[model samples]
Target: MRPEKIAEANEIDARVAGALYMILADYNGMDMPTTNELKKSLRENGASFNVVKNRMLNRALSEDASALLKGQTAMIYGDGDVVEVAKVIKKFTAAKKKPVIKGGFVEGKSISAEDVVELSKLPSKDVLRAMLLGTLQAPCSQLVGVMNQKVASLVYVLSAVIDKKEQEA
Candidate 1:
């Protein structure tokens, strides 16, 4: 390859690294076609995927490369929100009898394949938010009931006292 093309490829590698950083943190390398299909599946779900040379990617990340995804060199790439990428990977991979989520990294932290699957199992943000709201409302509902009961008891007690006083008068 020409020097300029090599440089361009390196630039592409860096981009792939950044994209992969947000996607697969580490991987258990798959066949070329499988990787391609993973990319296609992700793309259909609104995430883009890429396969990049290891050396170029390592150079691109400098010192922050995650060990899970680093060394020997090679990577699968995906892009979009990290959670979305994770969701896509988990969904397609789960559809198969055997899934390939090797393990991966995000920012600088290494993550495991099991971790990825676990993350996929998490309820969506909206669902979590709703659950929190329900929890918050539960306490408020209990408080409302307590206040109503206290007020009712106070009214009943005062009414009894007045009736007793009227009888004595």
Candidate 2:
């Protein structure tokens, strides 16, 4: 490889290494303006959209990831929320009807295109955390209510006994 090619591969490798997740998509038939808009949207959502040479990308990726690269591939990757990134891509694909999803890598595993769509359908991290919080608090809240009910029952019994004694007297 030429020195410039080697540098490009190294840069791609560094990007891949740092990413928490990556989505590969077909960028065929996308105009420059449309592609720039997609890149901007992804950037705002804390991900990057890069149209790299497939050969260079292959050099950077693991063997499993390399298999997904073919014909005008662009990589979307970030260290932030994977679901959010996937959502952005899904939205863009729906709006423009370009850049069809290929496949992805999440954590350390390669996933199918369907898996990428499924990931986009998932709730954001904040929403998922809120759901988990609600689940945890449910039991505690119920326990508190049950304890309060027992105390109230005891108090009611005590009050009734006092009234009965007073009426008898």
Candidate 3:
């Protein structure tokens, strides 16, 4: 490759490396339309899919990133939710299993292909956040309920006492 082309490729790789997470996969036998559709879907979900030269990716990323470059390697990268990206990849791969996730990096740590699958199984960020909010609010909600019952009981007891006094009079 010419120097200018190499520089442009390096720039692209650098941007991909800056993503929050990356999924390395094999895209050996996928048709162009399928590949384009996958790329489109990924882009819509905030991930950019690229068929990169292994050498270029290695140069742009860490030494460990090179481990996943054995087969026809492609990268899915973005600053969006990693789990969401993994879920998209998981769904796409389920339909056509060519671009199997090999491995990738998340938060600067390398993760195995199995890790990516497990990540896909996890709920999305919003769902997880809502679950946490529910959990945190549970105790507060119970406390409010108990306090309301206490106030109601006090009111009932005071009303009964007043009625008894009236009867005595």
Candidate 4:
């Protein structure tokens, strides 16, 4: 390989290694402004987008990941939330109808394009964590309420007994 090609491949490799997840797509018909818009959105979501040659991608990515590489491939990758990145891509696709999803690897496992869409549909990490916390807290809260109710009932019974004794006296 030429020196420039080697450098490019190294760069791709570095990006892949650094990212927690990557999504591949066919960005064939996307114009410059549209691509720029997508890039901007992805950047805001903590991902970077790049158009890479299939051969270079193949050289950089693993065997399973390389299988998705064919024809006008662009890679979107980030160290941030994978779901957020997928949401950005899905939103862009819904609006522009270009850069169709191919497939990608997340945390070293290859996933289908449909999986990427499903991921986009999911709540973000913080949301999921909050849901889990709520679920866990519900039972504890209920238990506390039940205990408090028993104590209140006891207090009411004692008060009623005191009133009856005073009336009898």
Candidate 5:
């Protein structure tokens, strides 16, 4: 390969390295239109997909990440929520049954295709935050309710005592 071409490939690899997740997929036997559609879908969701030579990809990725690359491979990388990107890919694969995921990594940890699919099924960060907030607030809410009930009971008892004293007088 020419020096300039290698430089360009290295640049692309470096760009992908900054993303939160890197997915390696096999696009073998997939039609051009389908692949283009997948690329467009990924692009719409803040991801870029490129067909990468396995050798070049292997060279670009870390040792652990590179182990996931083999055969005909394409790369998907995005700075957005990795789970959301995984969801998009999962949905696309379910519909098209092409571009099978070989493996991937997130934040330097290798993950299998099944792991990616499971990640896709996870709730978004916001939803998870909401759930945690609700859990944390539950006890406090209950504590307030208990305090209110005790005050109401004390008021009731005092009112009864005052009514009895008035009747005696």
Candidate 6:
């Protein structure tokens, strides 16, 4: 490859390094159409996958990107819906008898295949977000109930006072 071509490849690889790191960091490897299929599915689902050259990918993963490239930085590729990426990889692996997870960088740490399995077990971002919303709303709902009860008690007291005054008159 010419020096310029090599540089360009390296640039692309570097640009995708974060993505690759995310993939390998979250998954192992896939079989033929399964891999391609998964990649396609991810793209359709608002994510992406890439089969990048190791040399270029490695070049992109310099020490600066190490935090996100911690463990197996050499082979990694994917971007979008960080959690969804992992979930799709997980789903494909589960469906295919032999699609194994490799490794990946998560939040600047390198993780193993087993670690990726654990990642797969996690609920998606939306699920977590919903859980958070429910958690927040629970207390607010309880507060509203408590406030309404207090207002009802005041109303009852006033009603009783009016009833007694009318009887006395």
* Candidate 4 CA-lDDT value: 0.92
lDDT score of residue 91 within candidate 6: 78
Q: lDDT of all the models against the reference?
A: 0.63, 0.89, 0.88, 0.92, 0.85, 0.62
lDDT per residue for candidate 4 within 1-169, as digits (tens), equals 8999889989999999998998899999999999999999999989999999998888787765556887899999999999999988888899999889999989998889999999999999999999999999999999999999999999999999999999999
- Minimum summed lDDT over a 10-residue window in model 3 is located at 58-67
Clash number for every model?
7, 0, 0, 0, 0, 13
Q: All candidates: CA RMSD in angstroms?
A: 5.2, 1.5, 1.7, 1.3, 2.2, 4.6
The sequence of per-residue lDDT tens digits that candidate 5 reaches over residues 19-110 is 78888899988899999999888998898898877777766777655556667888888888887788889999999998899888788778
Clashes of 6: 13
Q: Which prediction has more favorable lDDT, 2 or 3?
A: 2
> Taking the tens digit of each residue's C-alpha lDDT, what string does model 2 give over 1-108?
899978888899999899998888999999999999999989998999998888887777776556687788989999999898888888988999988999988896
Best by lDDT: 4
Q: List the residue pairs that clash in candidate 3.
A: none
Model 3 clash count equals 0
What ranges in model 5 sit over 4 Å off?
64-67, 165-169
TM-scores for all candidates: the values are: 0.58, 0.92, 0.91, 0.94, 0.85, 0.71
lDDT of 1 by residue, 1-169 (tens): 8998698677765665556454443334556677677778767655655545555555565455545445333344545445656777777666643235556666656677777777677776677889999998999999999999999999999999999999999
Q: Write the per-residue lDDT of candidate 6 for residues 1-169, one digit (tens) a residue.
A: 8999787786675655545345443234444666677667777756656555444555654434433433322243455455666667677666774345556566556676777777667888789999999998999999999999999999999999999999999
Which candidate should be chosen as best, given TM-score against the real structure? 4
**Candidate 3, residues 1-169: lDDT per residue as tens digits?**
9998788787876876679988899999999999998999899889988888887787777655666889788888889999988998999999988688999988878899999999999999999999999999999999999999999999999999999999999
Pairs of residues clashing in candidate 2:
none
Task: Write down the worst ten-residue block by lDDT for model 1.
Answer: 20-29
Task: Give Cα distance to truth, residue 126, candidate 1, Å.
Answer: 1.9
lDDT of 3: 0.88
Higher-ranked by TM-score: 1 or 3: 3
The TM-score, computed over Cα atoms with residue i paired to residue i, of candidate 3 is: 0.91
Candidate 2: C-alpha RMSD to true structure equals 1.5
